[model samples]
Target chain A: MTQTNQPEINVQEKRPLDTGTAESTSSEPRFSPQVDIWENDRGLTVVADMPGVNADGLSIDLNDNVLTIHGRIEAQNPGKKVLTQEFEVGDYYRQFKLSEDIDKEAIAATIKDGVLAVSLPKMAPAQPRKITVVQA
Target chain B: MAFLPFFGRNFSGSFWELEKMRSHMDHVYNALADGFNQIRRNYTGVFPLVNISEDEDNLFLTAELPGLTADRLEISIKGETLTLKGAKTQDNAGDETLNYHRRERQAGSFSRSLTLPVKVKSEDVGAVFKNGILTVTLPKATEARAHQITVQAQ
Candidate 1:
């Protein structure tokens, strides 16, 4: 087994499956993770199920309303010699297109025990005013 | 509000039209099959996939997927719809296919599903895949998050 001297930057480019940006984006069969969303009066909260992933190997970034999450999970039996491998070992990839209503400046993320949580604050109306009407 | 579009719904206004408007949260859950032990829900324009006694508030979900990359996982949520889709490539181990005695690893494509409990922006979803495990972050709508309220006396 190999050990790292420092914490992983946890970026999308670190994945081995990132090549052929065209192949993954193409209409090819693939695997995806599960997600759960919750909304409040203030912002949005998202919970994603990512087993085998830890905090040091996770990353969260956004570009032009495109949120990207990338992480590396510890191999189940890295050093142990394997006779057979039923589970696939590769990078996880997914994409999402956001709307204009989200407050991009205040999105937060955390990974705990293989589960990732993200907080996205919603933008408020641009102007506020009180309406007054004269009684006729 | 009548003139406004239903977010995911296209001009056709058909239920299927929203398929193109999937968010990362929705994509992650939709990719999963029922597999005889799965529960999913869509509420407040969000998707939440839950099972019996699985309400740990911070439950964990790991899938058995091989021959895939981190960039392949698709997680998204549009309004209340969640979609998860990915494809496991064919195993290309050096000379392993020819000398294999028995093959039992499931291959090809995989998808998971889970409706949301609150509304979310598809662009805000986050996911990562590594060492055969894929992880994503599903953010709840600020209004749907658990919070404390104060009482005001008039």
Candidate 2:
């Protein structure tokens, strides 16, 4: 296995979605969930953090080589008076453009514990071949 | 390179330049915001961002902790203070051959403590972790709850 330096973990602040440019019709606030992506020889993997979003509330869409991930989180404990509102509960929306080497048809995804992982397999590279020289 | 994770390296040359400039601007803006937050909250950028709310019966504290199991988390409340501690480890840490393209999600131990507004029944506090969200319900103490006063007609 190739050796790689371990990344230092630090607390990352949440970024609210820019509703002005979003295509979604809902007026509810949305956030951009943090993600980790890596590529190996075989494929690329994307892991996203989307708390409070179950499998039923998540949607992954691909169009014209652009992949979009959206997760909806229903409001929790409604009608309760907020005391200390440090963070807001909202939906998650993010999109990415994939490279041409990826095989879009073979893409797979799974969601567990509000974490979504997506696998994008790379198209097999053309193998070089040697041709025998023949006198015609 | 630190901001490259925000935008992947799949854009064209000209577009990539624009993205890089945008990321630089964002970095500056974020730095300024962080400075302000340090002066105001003194506890900004804490892990597992939380929200506290209350109803008539119980006080609810919710925290977003994705990819963490119940066993990895520890929640405790003493007096009017609640403390949450947890560790998040990457499942793919053993795979060093993989080349990371974008890595914004972090893995490490985090702990946060907050003081409750009102008194709660320490023995009756209940917590549930579902869909990566941890919700702790602390029932209000009897003396802290609002009591109804009956009207007497003379």
Candidate 3:
């Protein structure tokens, strides 16, 4: 699996996603959510930090070899005057490319406390196998 | 030892001097790097970015803290200052044998204190944690609240 080129500065602060090439129709701004990806013998795991996003506001899709994750944040405070604003509220969007060795049908995702975890299991044939030798 | 002219008895002494100089430079470089890293961390700005809003009666403070539960957060108010403290634990990805492709999230303890514009009733403060967002409501003190005065026809 591989991800597109993302700048290193994105790790520090939330940045608005580039909408020049994307087909985003919503007027609400979208921010790229921070994620951590790791691979083990079983499969690959992706953990994302998406604060203010509930279970009903998250969506994950896989088309062809591209996997996309989108999260929406509902308006928390409405009609209240903002006194000191340090961060902006927006939705989250990110995408990743998957390899053929992964079992696309077996992918699963779970969310808790606004954090999302996606598990992509590897195909059986892609797993490493050990063979025992017998003396003839 | 006789192959080169500089490989005489002074070789060991000069070699020690060179080694000491190299070690000194190494220490200086490490210190400089540490200072840069410190500045970078701070330049990235504060953790759990907060937004404070207010109405006529109450002031609301909200912060985004993902992967944290209510028990991990502590909020306290003293005079006009409100303090928030919390620690975020790292997730367990089974074992250490896994190969990391990308890592961006951070886990550590954070403490932030902000002074409210107006004094609030400490005893009546309320806080709620939902969807990794923390919202604290502080009601304005009686004396600090705006009081509308009635005008009688003179």
Candidate 4:
């Protein structure tokens, strides 16, 4: 395999900070994201739209092909003490069952601007190859 | 609005500030934006506009529009302010069981404003709302668009 940089995860900062908008109801799970998956030549790209998550509070883990994402958002405290506030805070949880064809070791992830991207490279069998046969 | 993940820093305050009642008025401003409660670390998309990016000629603005129809979704520019307003609501629409479980998606009236970084032909703005996405195309003004005028020897 040719040498290239393994995908690294970095939390890109938000801009203008005004797009900093998010709301959660009392009973519903707060700050959950909806994920969209797209397959490409090299691997599968998962795009998850999760607004209000920040760099310091995110956790992504893979165990036995089960991918889990967890985060925590501090609840808003009412009645004074706050000046101007911007940024969404919430505890988050999401999990996915990854395909066996994926090369989990080569998986790369990045989270920025409340979007999470995961690239899952496929294994040898997952790629197409020409077959060789001899007549018996 | 108090962004949920951003309310932690605002958690500290004194009784005098609250007792004096100045803070009560400030809550209205936050309430208008829809306060963000319970903030945690999040995994969001990160696309950077760096010097090396080649596609600066085309501006991509993807607005999250869940239910608003094409008729309701409006994009207009007055002076320098670009305003987008729409509402996505269903009548008596959600299942009670689902709402009881976990409802994260925000479905209601939404109005967003964006100030363009560059001047564009306001009259030429084209907008399309499809599949819960609002894509607007604003042709760059003559001076704002890119060009290469080479100088020749006289």
**Best model per TM-score:** 2
Q: Write the per-residue lDDT of candidate 3 for residues A83-126, one digit (tens) a residue.
A: 98878889999999998888999999998888899999998874
Runs in model 2 with CA error above 4 Å?
Answer: A1-11, A19-25, A127-136, B1-41
- Give the per-residue lDDT of model 2 (tens digit) for B1-154: 5665566556455677888999999999999999987766545646667888899999999888888898888888899998888788876887888999888887777777788899999999999999888999999999999999999999
lDDT of 2 by residue, A35-117 (tens): 99999999999999999998889899999999999999966656999987778778999999998999988999998888999
Number of the predicted model whose DockQ against the real structure is largest: 3
TM-score, candidate number 3 = 0.76
Residues B37-141 of candidate 4: C-alpha lDDT, one tens digit per residue: 212222222211111111335444554343346786666797556776655443235433221222233345544455666677788877765443455666667
Greater lDDT among 2 and 4 belongs to 2
Q: How many backbone clashes does candidate 2 have?
A: 0
**RMSD (CA, angstroms), candidate 3:** 9.8
Give per-residue CA lDDT, model 1, range B2-37, as digits (tens): 654655456546534455555654766666654322
- What lDDT would each prediction earn against the true structure? 0.50, 0.85, 0.84, 0.52
Model 3 Cα displacement at B61 (Å)?
A: 0.5
Question: Residue A29 in candidate 4 has what lDDT?
Answer: 45
Off by over 4 Å in 1: A1-21, A24-31, A75-77, A127-136, B1-154
